[model samples]
Target: MSSIRGARVAALSAVVVAAFALSACSGGATDDPPASAEQTLRLSAQAPPSSWAIGNAPGGDATMYLSVYDTLLRTTPDAEITEGLAEEWEYNDDLTELTLHLREGQEFTDGEPVDADAVVASLNVSREGPSTATNLTAVSDVTATDESTVVLTLSQPDAALLPNLADVAGAIGAPDVLTAESSTLEPVGSGPYILDSSSVAGSNYVLKKNPDNWDADSFPFETVQFQIIADPTAITNAMQAGQLDWIALNTPDQLAQFPEPKYTSGSNNANGLGVLWLADREGTIVPALKDVRVRQAINLAIDRESIAEKLQVGSLHPTEQVVNPNGGAWSDELNETYSYNLEEAKALMAEAGYADGFAVTMPSTFLSTPYEPTFSQQLGDIGIQVTWETVPFQDFLTKVFSQNYGMYFMFNAFRSADSVDVRGATTAIFNPFNSTSPEYEALIAEANSSESADAFAPVNEYFVKEAWFAPIFYTAGPWVASDKVTYTPAKTFYPSLKPWAPAN
Candidate 1:
């Protein structure tokens, strides 16, 4: 199948951790095929979806959403925009208009032709629909130039438009599927793979493969089953018992128990934004947080090394910036500003009249297995009494939307390749904080108005300097492959069996 070739040149699939790979080596085949005629891969994770609704579901559902959907464009493991359903694409000089060239003979699993109109309808639904995760609201109109071509006209130049389109929530579906019922069903896409079957039986889910993929017949595995096993010991037991081949190490103890799984470490963009929200409550410690000294105290107290040593799984990289190190435009200018300094933290606390170090409640989501608990402890060590209120991912979002939490994790899902001036980050937090920063607002406008992406840097610098949002480490997961299963890591997404076979 022909797909966009040029974006691959720019590393379109810029993902923090490039551990997702095909299961085979480059130009090498699995030496010994599995004994079973139909290979069933048992993949395990802590994330289990309550419903497959992209617009409504809380966090922890990205894994399933990504695997079972398709977008017009995708990010490289390194965060570049590569081609997907569209064979080729071009952004106008002003960055306001984008044209995508679709692959010929592409059809959804449900037999609907993957045409330009379908793409337009799918995007429009996400724009006007209840899917808040679909960051394409900036788009004003979408028109099919022809059967194989679609043109997207944004209200303004959105530098991150391509990467935003890569979002799983923005996955294109059959027009009729959206109209069928309010209930969720299998999403129809025109990617190289398809969801053959998915069922949540008890705590486990089974997802098979569609043999009618548009790509070449190189993918070795025929079926992929995702098991939602909660117990770390149970996961280890499954691995030892040969009942499971791939299992995520949820905690440090769990990772220690199973030391042999090949560990792949990288960064992700899910780390919560560093924010100093103005608390609206009548009586609260947050009014003090309005002071820059207090905010600086919070920043200085963060010991990223301890968190890395204690919480980072399978050798994931430690970071101090929200955009991540692998993210091309990530600014290190703020690094010295938020560096770990207990003495400085104490001084700032005293300066803010909190020499006693006030106690505060830190509401967080248990869905983020690595960061929340560690972050709470980091603040606790610096004389700030931190009481963690672990809530579900959905609850966290609602609380944030209401601005009820003094401090919480808000993961900024970037839709475009890492540009220095991040419109999504600004739009997500800035609008809530101070939508009127002429400089910040102007940057967003300028980024869209730039003749090319090269002109976006000047405006992006304002965000990095003003500390509108604190930077945190990238949140990438470990990709461990059994010795028996050798695959190339596809950094842009979760590991798949597409590129591998059984090793001799």
Candidate 2:
């Protein structure tokens, strides 16, 4: 139920205002007094850093890379595929290779023709590049067969090939523009927007319209500024001050403040899975998490209904499956069987030898704070005393990934709607038989190798019913535009909302 909005929302909103101003100047304002269509959209965020370059680079930031750049394909909330840089593609009978036909005439801001070579170059960069999504290393090779045709060969028959390409790692940019250092701050891509600047500490990113875009006529906004505001109250206040067009409200309390059309609710196909990591480290709580019983007890004690109501602000529905309700070929199996039950949780704790109780501290960040209360409440109901410590996301990433924190929340968005598409990465997390799970690895492996979607249904059922992960809710953040801005409705999140043209 915790409402949250991303800082990128404010950045795009600013660009939307700027584009409006340009529109007014282009058209004569008549007797109503010549008002310059030139709009200087100002956006405010609670504590967003001023600079962050998110891309194929090592220090890449997520919000910058996704919000300002474009992807090869897009997936809808229902897991359907839509055109991105590639207008269409076809796979061989074996599903081992895919040939994509790039859209004609699409070019980077630098005017480099978006051709087969460009596609190969983009993929190669990520395949061997330092990126959050380094899994592309699994790609065998990329061959440019013709001007617009590029064929991709993977190590295995990846049914989720196209959908995976929709990820940020697949952002298509110019070959020449990419350099070891340039990636840190400079971004050159075929998306509607271009990177203008990045904050000193790599916290925020600024973007502008790509005038040379093949669809420039449809590209609306002129400029955008994304700040690293991570605080919910500050995000809400910014909206009230007209400093933001749209933001991802992070908590239920934050959502209640909005009246109606001004702020709306939508389901994001992505979901966050609760993780109680067990790796040992200093000043950490993992030593206790190593016990499977403890992990199970925590999952059982969660009150999904209360959390959804308090934080969702009536915008979302609780989820059981890792996939969203609108999930595609992979999520037809999700239902309400995973309800909350405090009694079962207590029993699990007792079985774990903690009949009295255990005290634990959860390391969390801005994105996870709103959910902390709900987590704490549920644990308390089961005789567990929980204290949550708030940490910055950047710091947490640097610290927690190394086992610095025992328990935390992990977020995974569906790279594609296809079941095969999601299974690849998700398998890495839940696979219990991997060296990480030595004992229960079969549970995760079965779900991953199952040839038929139906065959994997049982394994998938176990993960959901066992409460291995406490599911929250799915939410699609609303993109509220100033009526003056005009845009093409995109099925995915990559298309810049600000580049939308201004009303004449």
Candidate with maximal TM-score: 1
Tens digits of lDDT, candidate 2, 1-504: 111123212111222111111000000011121133354333333333222223343221133344445667755423456677788888777666778888888876677787889888778767765342445644688999999898888666544455557655567777776654555556667776667654333344456667666444443445555554545556567666666654444443455665665544333323322233323312234344555565566666766667657655444455666543433333544555545767776777788777777776667765566567766777788777877777765465455545444555544332333343235324432322222333234654543334464544554565555444555554443333333433222232322343234445
Which 10-residue window in model 1 sums to the lowest lDDT? 1-10
Q: Tell how far residue 479 is off in model 2, in angstroms.
A: 6.6
Candidate 2's TM-score reads: 0.71
- Name the TM-score of candidate 1: 0.75
Q: What lDDT, from 0 to 1, does candidate 1 have?
A: 0.50
Q: TM-score per candidate, in order?
A: 0.75, 0.71
lDDT of 1 by residue, 1-504 (tens): 000000010111111111111001011123344444256656655435444443432232244454555667755544456667787998777677888998877777778887888888777767765444336766888899899999989887665566667654456777777545532655565554555445754455555555555542544566666666655456557766667655433333444544554432112223223232323222243565565566667767777656656554433334444453434445556455667888988898898788877677656543343466666676766667767677654455465556555555443322234442254454433333433356657766765565463455555455444444444444333333455554443333322244345433
Q: Model 1 segments beyond 4 Å from truth?
A: 1-38, 53-63, 129-134, 201-203, 216-218, 250-285, 310-318, 331-334, 349-359, 364-394, 409-416, 419-436, 446-465, 470-478, 491-504
